[model samples]
Target: MKDNLVDNNAYTYYHTVWQNGDVAPGTHYLDVTANDKFEGIVKVYVTRRYDADNDHVKAFAIAGANDGSEFEKVADVELPNAVKAGKAEAEFTIAEGKSYSKLRFTVTSTTLERGYWHMAEFQLRPMTLNADCKNATYPEAFAAITKALEEANKAVGSVSVEDIAALQNAYDEYKKAINPETGIDAIGVETLRNNAVYDLQGRRVQNIGKGVYIVDGKKIVR
Candidate 1:
């Protein structure tokens, strides 16, 4: 497929045998949700079951298709051959002035072909550039309101654990500090307690072992 500014990569594996299967023996479909797209030079790696003599299909190539019917070759050369059994790493470049959405691998006859080849271990990652981050466009006025809230919070210090239960009051005080005339901010005071100490859902928990209980999403060491 064509490469663009957005770096995306993915993996595909034909674990099932062709010909004997319902689909044809040539092309198969792959899900890209697990792997992302590619932006520039992508490392193509695969592990296959079959090999052709010494010249066995050491490497493979990529073809892009928008509708899955007609296909066009993207890379000129086949990926480097994998001498080992499981993985082969071949670098393929996304050509300039072109972008691709979908790609597939075409398997030519290799030397050792008893059954069809079984392939796996695919990867595509960005090498040239990072993706862009756009600013949130909804709130032109909310920017100033947020800035005032930050300044007011800086004037206040951290709340202690004993007073942690009173965290809801902090939001009210900040709202009042910003708008002295109207106390409406205090009307809808909401408190956010990080229950992750006992729960494990909202935050990313790490360093957990077996037989642990996850509460709310956090791992509780048993």
Candidate 2:
């Protein structure tokens, strides 16, 4: 039995690097929670290809963790045919259920005369028992939005009359359940735009000429 887990039931990663993106290498972090029954082999499967000549480098690796820290390299493999035929990959294991942060891959080759290697995609998957539906906390998901609103309020205090009207209209529509899916909370955008007065002809009434005019965290011109 293991204490860590990898859930790969949702999405798959893919890539194809051509002349424009001749080479690519990076890392990705995923947040997941453990199930009541936490024990399985964390599996990472990578599908990649090199598109070059005399390119000598092709490989992929996987690492695992228990609490997103203290990572350990568990799986590593070299693609023998990739250097010659430009195709190779491997799968490896790690403990599952905790949280693995750094799962990465590196490819080094010289194909297409770019002096750098070209790759398709290096992907990773974690094996799990099943029943994993962990999601983000409300505060965690709204952190960026809250931060933006705070910055906007610092620049411009209070919502304007026009914004208040818009908010009311939106709220009325929401209350009536008209197009229930359409209305986003007008609390943010309305507050900012309301402060700025505009003429009936749709021109900015404020004499905001030349210099920068920051409205609701966005810059505007005269």
How far is 164's C-alpha from truth in model 1 (Å)?
Answer: 39
What does the lDDT read for residue 210 in candidate 1? 21
TM-score of each: 0.39, 0.30
Candidate 1 per-residue lDDT, tens place, 81-180, comes to 5543334556777776544566655544344422233553444544344344111231332344344433433333443443322333443344444453
**Residue runs of model 2 more than 4 Å from their true location after superposition:** 1-51, 54-61, 65-68, 83-87, 96-99, 106-118, 132-222
Q: Model 1, stretches more than 4 Å misplaced?
A: 1-14, 19-37, 48-57, 67-70, 80-85, 113-116, 131-222
**Residue 204 of candidate 2: its Cα lDDT?**
41
lDDT per residue, candidate 2, 1-222, as tens digits? 011111111122233343554444332223234333223455333222323333333454444555536656655655445432222444454544344544433443223223233333333333343443211222332333334433433334355555434434443443344232322323224534666633211234344322224355244332
Q: How accurate is candidate 1 locally (lDDT)?
A: 0.40
